[model samples]
Target: MSLPVVTPGETDTYEDPLDLINEIDELKKEKDASIMAHFYVDGDIQDVADYTGDSLKLARDCTQVTTGTIVFAGVHFMGESAKIMNPAKRVLIPDMLAGCSLADSCPADQLQVFQEQLRAEGRKFDTVAYINTTAAVKSLCDWIVTSGNAAEIIDRVPKDREILFVPDQHLGRYLMEVSGRKMILWPGSCMVHEVFSIQGLVRAKRNNPGSVVIAHPECPQNILEITDFIGGTEKMRQHVMSVKEPTTFLVATESAMIHAFQKSAPQHNFIPVPGIIASTGETCACNRCPHMARNTLQKVRDCLKNESPEIEWRDYFQQARAVLDKSLLK
Candidate 1:
């Protein structure tokens, strides 16, 4: 796929970044497009999105929207999900290279081999794929789920059936513990979520006493153990909003979500969990996903203006819908 062309070193040098937002809005209207952004994208992208939420929510919105085009302001898999939902609509992403590390972990061929081995062993099982996967990997699964509905969807599986949970071992473990159902887990992880330094988090907590710790289930066990609340993005926001008492929170997810939380609850303080300390004693910017950061206002404007970087779904993508439609939510 050809992406919008901007000269090297031109990403941050938009003549006026504010003007790009206006241009993007005009293009959206002219193209009859709606923007769907993930919570982890840049704050400016989120601000311009017609719908901004978790993966599942954005996919659902894509199916429901009457717009002829869907401009996804997040990562590549997210754009693919929107394409899966609306096969005929034009789906575009700001950056075609904005990929997910978790999605990269499970190749379709590897999953196919695993499934074949399971069947050869007389194991009849259902596969549950996290939404953070490639369209090809998702096509291989019986059901697709987000962290918010994973446990609920998994519970609906018959008690006698074995299950395979993929593309995020930490999330799989969390589901296994919560639902008390054992399953084979694919060893995959989000780089940003997995690198949070336990030492750094502990230190931050001690320094900011009385702060509640909120973490995504994708975090490691050590992070979860110290977490006051563990949930998906929307659920985390709801938890913070539900509490009337003003409280400080140490968040252990993508740094961009902190911006959303602060916007939702400006009265409360939200500090991101620092990454592992370098030899210089400085923490890495591990809380941010480099892929997510690939998106910028300049890219958005250029993609919308040119209408390039459109996602094209293969025939298998269409076939996958038959299996997906049989599962709960399409």
Candidate 2:
């Protein structure tokens, strides 16, 4: 049976995101459809989502919900994860093209070859993928991890065991630096988080005097080294909410987060660490991960109605399921 399609107002008549936001509740039956949005997306979208959370929290959510249709407002990687976990259910992304630079940094074939090499050396790894990765990557991984739980989760592996950490080299390095462990790290990165230049960071610190630098662990060590606090998107948001009497904060992550931070802690101030690479006098350069930006109220509506851009998990569920089961087997 075909799903009902709701036409979004693309014309001059509908100007408010709230209008589209409200329409979703009525269009998609409250019981059947649910939206899972990340902290980095537009605030209005987050506001409209059935549930809003950071990556790790959302990963856990895949177990809790029983929705027939899932519309993830985050990047392709995240939506793909939801689908991988819920193959029986329909998983849709507002924009199928919305992609993650971090996931794209390491190709599937290349990583598979590396895994083969490690096996040849008699080394076995328990793959723990970041939620920022693609379904294919997650499919290959033994378990999934978010920044909130990476440290705790990864720590469970044997001390002498060799592991391959994917995508964000900065976060990998940070984990290694903090834990004093050795794991082969893939040289992949997040385009948005990786763009905060060390030079510009210094300038911000110098100018802001009293402002403390708080960054995501995915940032380069040089950036994370001088930071006052280092954590994930949710951690950053909490720091802003819980902290008091801070004059200013230099946030070294996606600019979208500034909206929520400002809204929650109006007393303090924030500055988005400028992405020098995104605007280097180029003809066109926008650092916002195109994948994360593809979602809109209009796209969300289309996905609910047509289920047009559905994500499919490639491997047998038991394959990935076994890996997750083994790693999570306590």
Q: Which candidate ranks first by lDDT, i.e. highest?
A: 1
Task: Count steric clashes of candidate 2.
Answer: 2
Tell me the lDDT of candidate 2: 0.73
- What TM-score do all the candidates reach, one by one? 0.93, 0.86
Q: Which tens-of-lDDT digit does each residue in 1-330 have in candidate 2?
A: 011122364332334666776778776685388888887777677777777778776756765677788888888777766776667778878876677788888777788888888899899776666667765666677666677777877888776677688877888888888777787889988878777777777887898888988888888788887899898988888888888886699888876677668877898998877666555532222235445655667777667777678777666554655554444333
Which residue ranges in model 1 land beyond 4 Å of their true spot? Answer: 1-12, 277-282, 326-330
User: Lowest-scoring 10 consecutive residues by lDDT in candidate 2?
Assistant: 1-10
In model 1, state the lDDT of residue 8.
70
lDDT of each: 0.85, 0.73
> At residue 21, what lDDT does model 2 achieve?
67
Residue pairs with backbone atoms closer than 3 Å in model 1 (clashes) = none
